[model samples]
Target: MIALDSIIGTLNLDDEQKFITYLQKKNKRKDAKNIDLFKLLSKSTLDSKAICNQLYQTKNSNAYHALRKRLFQSLIDFTANKNLEDENSIDMQIIKYILASRTFLIQKNYQVAYKILDKAEYLADENLLYPILNEIYHTKIQYAPNYPKINLEDLIRKQKENQNKHQLEDQLNIVYAKLKTVLNSISHESKIINFEIELNDILKSTDIELNESLSFKSLYQILAIANISALVTNRYYEIESFVLKSYEILKRKKETNKQLYYQIYISYIIANTLFRNKKFTSSLNYLKEMEDLMLLKKGVYFKEFILKKTLVEALNHNYTDNQDKAISLAETILKKKHNDIESLLDLHLSLLMFYFQKGQLLKAKSVLSKFYHTDQWYIEKASIDWVIKKNVAEILLYIELESDALLISRLRSFKRSYSNYLKQIGQTRILKFLNLAEKIYKNHNYLTSKTFKTDVEEAFERNTANKEDIFVISFYAWLKQKINKGDLYKTTLKLIQKQ
Candidate 1:
C-alpha cells in the first residue's frame, strides 16, 4: 500500500492524466476497479483498510488485495512505457537499428546488413553508447569470415576498448555506492571516522582520472562524488577549482543531445559548490547557465532539477540580504508534489531559518511543523547532518517561544543523540551554543550578562583569517542577538559581512 502511494505521489498532473488515458485504452472490463484504486491512492489520504472499505463496501480483503495488485502493475507498465517513449528515445532508435540489421544478416543480405549496422554503430559511437556499440561490434565480428571487407582484428580491438569503458563505468558505480554507504555511516554511527580519508580511499581505488575519455554519465558521477564529499566535509573551497575545471572541459566538448542530462547536472554541481564557497554572484551565474540548459528538449530536465536550482538561488538570496525573495522562492516549491524529499526538507529548513532570523516565531514554527517525518525517516531520506541542524533549529525555536517543557525535552534528546558525534567532529561551538541557550532558559538575566557574553565570545572565537560557512555564522548570530538584544536579521548580516 505504501509502495503504491509512493509511485502515485511521484507523478505530476500530466503524468496522472496520461496514466488515466492509458488505463482507458487497456482496461478490458467496465467493472475494472484499478482506476478507482489508483485515484484513491493518488490522494494519499487513507489507510489501506479504509481504502478497502471504500472500494469494496464490505470486508473483502481478497478482492481489495487483488485490486491493489492490478493497480500496481498498471502503474509499472505505464511508467516503463513512458520512459521508453520519452527518456530513452535514442536507445530505442539504436535498438531498432540493431534489430533491422540482424534481420538483414539472417537473410544473407550482407551489403544491406553492413549498411544498417553502420548506421547503428555511428549513432552509438556519437553518444558513447558503449554497450550498444559492443553489440554492434559482436554482430560484425560474427559475420567477418563471410565478408571480405570486415576487419576482424580491428573489430576485436574496438570491442576490447568498449569493454574497458563499460568496466570503468561499473567501477565508478561501485565507488558511488561505497560513498553513499560511508556517508550514511557517518550520519548514523557513533564510531569516529574521518569521512574525507574514507572518500579519498574509495575514489583512489577506482583510479578514475578527470581527463579519462569517459562517457558524460561517468563524468557526472565523478563530479557528484566530489560535490557530496565537499558537502559532508566542508571542503567546498578545495573542490571548487576541480568542479569548475571539469565543467569547462565538458563545455568545450561537442556533446551530443544524449549527454544533456549529465551536462545539466554537472552545471548544477558547480553552481552548488560555488554557493557553498560563498561565491554568491558566481553561483547565480552558473545557475543561469543551468537554467538555459534546462530549457533544451522542451524542458525535459527542468522539473528534474528545479528544486535544486531554486534551493541554491534561495540560499544565495538569503545570505545576500534578500530573505523575502528567498522565502517567496521556497514557498513556491512547497505547494507541489516532489519526490526530491531531501530538497523538500532543505527548503523547509531554509524557510524556518529565514523566518527565524526575521524574529517571526509563529511563521518559523509553522515551517518547522512541516517536518512531520520521524528521525529515522529523515536519516534515511536526507542525512544525519540535516537531522542535527533541524533538531538544533527546533530547540532554538522552542526557546524563543519560551516553551520550556518542549525546549528541555528537545535539548536533552539532541544532546543524548549528537553530543559525542559533534565533539568528534570538532564542533564544540554548537554544544556551547546549546549550553548558553539552556542557561538563558533557566535564568533569563544571564542572557544579557557580561560574563555570559564573554563566554559566548570564547566559545565561538572566530579565526579571522578563515571565512566561516554562512550557515555556521547564522546559528552563531542567534546567540549574539540574544545577548545584545539586537535584530537577529541584522546581526546575521553583520556576521556574514565580516566573514
Candidate 2:
C-alpha cells in the first residue's frame, strides 16, 4: 500500500481538500467514508484502529484495509486529473488540442474544429514539435473537404518538412541513447581501454556527421561521450580540451533544458582533470564552481553532483597530504544520507583509504567495519570494481596493522578469489600489485634489514618504470618510504606531485 505521508505530501492541504471535494462530486454523495479516512490519516498520529473505529464505529482490520485501498485509488485518480489539468508541455498541449478538434469534427462542429486545429498548428510550429505538427497537418488534410479555405498542397508540403525534421531528431536521439548506455557500462578504470574503440564503433555505425548543422542535443551527446571516454582512459589533457570547448558552446547557447547539466558536467571534468594532474588547489576552485552550479538546480541530480564534488575534493586533499581536510570532507559525506548505493560505497572506500593514508589504523579499521556491515542489498547494488576496491582496502588495513597471521590468511584467500577475477577481467595491473604486496609483506623484515636497502630501491625502480604498477594505490611510494626510512605520506605526496 502507498504510504499515507507520500500521498499527503504529493498533494498540499488545498489540493488534498480539492481532491476530497472531487471524490464527493464523483461519487454523488455528500458524505464520503473515504474522505473521513483521508482526513484521519493526514493527521498521521492516530492508530489504524482508532481511525477505523472513528470512521466505521468498529476496530475491524478488513474494513480498514478496504478503506485504505479505496483512498489510495481515489488519490491516484485525483493526481492523474490534476496533472492533466496542470500540464504545460507544448507538445502535449498540441496533442490535446488536436484530439479536441477531432472530437468537435465528429460532433459536426466544423467551425470550432478548424479554430482548434489552427491553434494546435501554431503551438506545434512555435515549439518545433515536428511530429505533432505532422499530426496537425494530417488532421487539416482529413477535414480539408469541409473547409474550402484550407490549401491541401500547402498542408502536404508542411507535413513532409516536419516528417524529415522528426526523422533527423529521432536518429540523433538514438545515437545519444546508445552512447549513454555505453558510458554507464564502461565506467570502471579497467574497462576504459575499450572505451575509445567502442565509441568509435558506435560513431561509425550511426554515421553521425558532427558539423555546424548539428543540433544542441547532438553536440551535448558528443561532448558527453568524449568526456567519459577521457575519464576512463585517464587522459586529463584531452578532457580539459573538451571541457573548454563545451563551456564555450554552452555559454553561446545560453540557458537550455540541459544547460545546468552541461555546466555541472564541464565543471566536474575540469576539477577531476586537475585532481588527476595533482593540481589540488586548482581542482578545489573548479569543485567550488560545481557546487555553485548545483545550487542553481535543486533536485536528485543536484544532490548527486554535490556528492561527486565532495568525493573529488576529499581525494584532492588526501593527495596533497592534507589529512585533516580529507577526513573532515569524508566525515561530512558519511554523515549525510544518500539514496545512491554506488556513490555511498565509493565514499566508504575513499574514506577508508584516507584514514589508512593518515596512518590511523584504528580509524581505518572503523571505516572498514562500516563497509563490512553494508546491507546485503547495497552490496548487490554496488559495482564489481567498487567491491574489489573495498576488498583491497581491507587487505591493506590488515597489512598496516601488522596482523601477520590474519594478513597472510586473508592474502591467500584474496589471491585465490581476486587473481581469477582480475585475470578474467584483464586487470593485470591490479593483480600484479596484489601479488607484489603479498610478496613484500611476507619478506617485510628482510626488506627492512640494513643490508637489503638496495634491494628495496631496486624494487621501487622496477615497479615505477612499468607505469601501470604505479597507477595502482601507490605501492611503489610505500616501498620507497620504507627503503629510505622517510615519512610514507610525504613520499606519496612528492611522488604524486612529480607526476
Candidate 3:
C-alpha cells in the first residue's frame, strides 16, 4: 500500500518516467474494468489505491461481474496468445492478465483476485516450465493454492531433487528450492521452529547440495532469512559463502522479479550486516531502504518482514513510539513459543538498551528481571547481559561515589530496582554482594574501615564470572586486577580467549 511503488531494476530516471507515463497513458490505474496486469509487481509498493475502493458489493454489481467476466476471458486470451508464432507480443498480453488481477486485490475481493491468479497459474503452468512457475508459486500460494498447498511429500521430493543437484554454480536454483521449503514450512497453522532451524543450518552449512527445482534469483530471496538470522547472532561470517553465491547470481540477472526480489533480500542482508557489525548510522539508512523495498513485496512471509522491521525499529526509535514490532513479534514467537531462549536474550537485551536510553528505569528494571540469570544462553546473551549488568552497576557506583547531594538526587530519580536478587541470594554470591558493595561504595562508606575494605576485596575477588563466557568473566576479572585487588582476572581472560 506504499506510494511510489519502487521504480525497480536498472531503469534510469528517464526510463522510470517513461514507465510512469505509460501507466498514466494506459489510464490503467483508473480502469476498474480494464485492470492493468502489467504493473502488479515492479519492486515498488503496489499502492493498493488503484483498486482500493473498486470492490464489488454484490455478485450482480457491475464491477464484480466484469471481474468475473475478465477472469474467464483472460484465460482464453492467454491460451490463444500462447499458441501464436511470435513469443514477444504474446508474453506481454498474458503478463497483463496477471497485473490486472493484482490491481483487483486492492478492490478488496481477495478471492476473485486470487481466482484470477489461479487461472493464470494453471494456464501458465501449462504454458511455461517450472523455473517461471516458481516465480509466482510462493505469492499465489499465499493468496490461493492451485493444488493441495501442504503436499509435504511433493515438497520433500523436490528437496531431494535439489539435494542431488546441489552445487556452487547451481546456487541460485538451490535457494529457490529452499524457498519452496520455506513456504511449505510456514503454511501450516502452527509455527515450525524446526523448519526455521533447518533453514538456518542450510544457509550456514558448507556442504550444500545445489539441487534446485526453481530459478537462481528466487533462491537468493528465500535464503535471505537464514542469512539475516545469522547476522543477528554475529555469525554472518558463517553465511558469507551463501551470501556471496546469492549476490553473484543476482548481479548476473537482467532485472526480473527474481532479480528485484533478490535485491530486496540482499539489501536487507547488507543492512542487517551493518547493524550487527555496529555501523548503526549506515545500518539505519540501509534498513530504511530495505524496509521500503520489502513493502514493495520484496520479502516473503509476515515473519520475515516483522522480524526485520523489529530490527529496524530498534535501531531507529528515540521517543518510545516504535515498539520495534518486528523484534516484539520475534520475541513473542522465538521466546514464548519457539523456546529460542538465546534469541530471546538478545532481543530482550536490545529492548533493555531501549529502555535505558529513555531513562525508563522502572521498565528497564522489569525487563532486567527476565535477563539477569538465564540458564539457557552459553554464548553471546549470557556474556553480554552480564557485562551490561556490571556497566549499569558501575554507573550507579559512579553517580553515588561522588558523595554529592545533586548526584544522589539524580540517582534516586532513576527509581529502578537495582536487583534485590542479591538480598534474596545473600552476600556470599557475587551478584548480591556486589549489589551491596556498589551501594556502599557510592555512599563512600566503603574503604572507611579495615572490615569494609576486606568486604570490598572479598566481593571484588568473587566478581569473577567463573562459570562460562571467559571473555566476560575475564574482562570483569581484568577490571578487578586493574583496581589492584583481583585474584584470577589475568588467568581467566587467558583461558577464555583460548576457547
Candidate 2: regions farther than 4 A off: 1-197, 211-220, 227-240, 256-259, 277-282, 297-301, 373-380, 404-406, 424-426, 449-475
Rank candidates, TM-score, best first: 1, 2, 3
lDDT for 208 (candidate 1): 73
lDDT, model 2, position 303: 62
CA RMSD, predictions in order: 2.2, 6.9, 16.9
For residues 1-499, what per-residue lDDT tens digits would candidate 2 score against the true structure?
A: 5586566655545677798788778776566688788877776688777777888887687877877887888888888776566433455678889999999988878889999999998776654566778888888898888878778889888888778667766776776677666655654322333666777777776665544334344555666667666545545555666656655655565244443555676677778766765667989998988877777634424765777788888888888768789889879877865655566677777887777767888988887777645433443566455666677777777877888887887777767755765775466656655665676677777665764556554544544421222235365666567667788778877777655
List, residue by residue over 195-301, the lDDT tens digit for candidate 1: 88888788676677776477788888888888778767666778888888876666666664657888788888988888877888999998999999899988878
Tens-place lDDT digits, model 3, residues 230-259 = 522335545645654655564564433333
Q: In terms of TM-score, how similar is model 3 to the real structure? A: 0.34
**Cα TM-score of candidate 2:** 0.67
Question: Which one wins by TM-score: 2 or 3?
Answer: 2
lDDT of 1 at 275: 83
Q: What is the alpha-carbon lDDT of model 3 when measured against the actual structure? A: 0.45
The candidate scoring highest on TM-score is 1
